[model samples]
Each structure stands twice: as structure tokens, then as C-alpha cells.
Target: MVAKAVVKPAVELPVRADEDSWTEAELAEVRATLEAEMAALVAEIAHAESTIAEDGGGDGAGDDQADAGAKTYEREHEMALAHNARDLLVQCERAVRRMDAGTYGVCESCTRPIGKARLQAFPRATMCVACKQREERR
Candidate 1:
């Protein structure tokens, strides 16, 4: 017996269907915001890494218990900050890729246009407000 091939529906491009979608000017603005955020995150990550490295070289040769504890705490704090910066940088990079692919300003989950106001407030968003709310609830 021959098996039937399953045909999937064609994916729709992220064309705007309503005023809620982004305008060209809005897209440009979002791009600029993402770029600025990415630059700041990169710089922050670099500084954190440098501070962590500089603090790691100490042998604690003459340090008291409190000094060692303080150094450890500071190093851990810098590491946590660097990790968060890296996460934000990755999100910014993904937003830029979506813009290039003509898929920006659309919700990833529902395939609907995200609201302009939401995008302006949070350029790293990949989903519409409703979808994001549902996700957060889950």
C-alpha cells in the first residue's frame, strides 16, 4: 500500500493586518533600541569578566577570614551580573535576526501581530502581550 503524503499549510509572512502592527518608523525605532541595548550589555559583560578575572588571581596569602569571604562574595556577584548581561545580549541579537527575516513584531506562539506599544516598551519581546501573559501564567 502506498502511503499518503501530508501537506502542511504555507506559513504566512508577518504582514501587518491591523493598526496594532508596527509601522516602518516603529520598526526603525525598535531596531535602534535593540542596538543600543546590545552595546551596553556587551560592555557590561566585559567589565564583569575583567573584574572577576582580576579577583581570581589572589592566593589569599595574608588575608583574614572576612577578607576572603568578601572577595568570594564580590566574585560571585560579578559572575551573576555577567550571566544576566549575556542573556540580554542573546535576546537582543535574536530580535535583530527576526527584524532581518521580516518576522519582527509578530508573536512567536500565536503567529499574530504584536502590539506596537508593547514592542516599543520591550523590544526584546518575541510574543504578543496576551501570549506572554499566558506563558507567564503557565
Candidate 2:
């Protein structure tokens, strides 16, 4: 019988000794990226609210049936987007908290420094790439 190979867990990287492990420049970049994303999400929510408001401006007017249907669809779509954005905002807030706690780059699952590239792509990631992949599998 053939034996299945065991997958080893990824190794953790050493934490930097300096108080501010990440360079000030890097922290600034991350802050800017997060702020921009937050602004965009808020704008999207405003736009959705405006659209719904416009659809419901009239007071018991003609074509109420069509207006009701359109308003319902818009509300559902807007609500979904709002919920997703709210969740992402929560994640972003947690990442910012980690930065303040001096554990921003360290992966929550393995205590490893998530590489610069990964941090740039996913600033809110709490797990390293390997751990994240493993989580997705389950």
C-alpha cells in the first residue's frame, strides 16, 4: 500500500527587534491604501441610498407597481453591498489595531511575517498564504 505524504505546517519568521518593525514609509502606504478603500465604500453606499430615494420620491402616484418592484430590487442589491462593505471595514479596523499592537505583519495562525507582497495585496490578512490556503480547503 502506498503511504500518503504528510503536509508540514509553514515555519514562522523571526520578529524584528525594533519597536517599529515596519518602516514609517511602509506604514504610511498601508494607511493610505486603507483610507482610499474606505472612502470608496462609503461613496458606494451613498450612491445606492440616493438611487433608492429617487425611486421612492413620488407619493402614491401612477405606475406604483413598477416603482415598488424597482425599489425592492434596488434595496436588496444595496443592502447586500452595504453588508459586505461593513464586514470588510471591520477587518480593516482589526488590521489597524494590529499595527498599533506591533503585530501587523505577523500571521495570526503561525506568528510568521506575512511577506511584503502579500501585505500590499491584502492588508487585512491575519494568516500567511499557506495557512490561508489550508483554511480554504476546509
Report the number of the highest-TM-score candidate. 1
What is candidate 1's lDDT per residue for 1-138, written digit by digit as tens?
Answer: 996544221133253456444456667777889999999999999899999999899899999999999999999999999999999999999988777766767799998887667777998989998899999999
- List candidate 1 stretches off by more than 4 Å: 1-21
Model 1 alpha-carbon miss at residue 11, Å: 18
Clashing pairs in 2: none
Q: Candidate 1, residue 33: CA error in Å?
A: 1.0
Worst-scoring 10-residue span by lDDT in model 1:
6-15
> What TM-score should be assigned to candidate 2?
0.69
Q: Write model 2 residue lDDT over 1-138, tens digit each, in one string.
A: 996544221222223343334556777788688878877877877776776677657665565788778767777887788778778877887776666656677888888777656777888888879989998999
Q: Per-residue error at 108 for model 2, in Å? A: 1.7
Candidate 2 Cα outliers beyond 4 Å, as residue runs: 1-21, 50-70
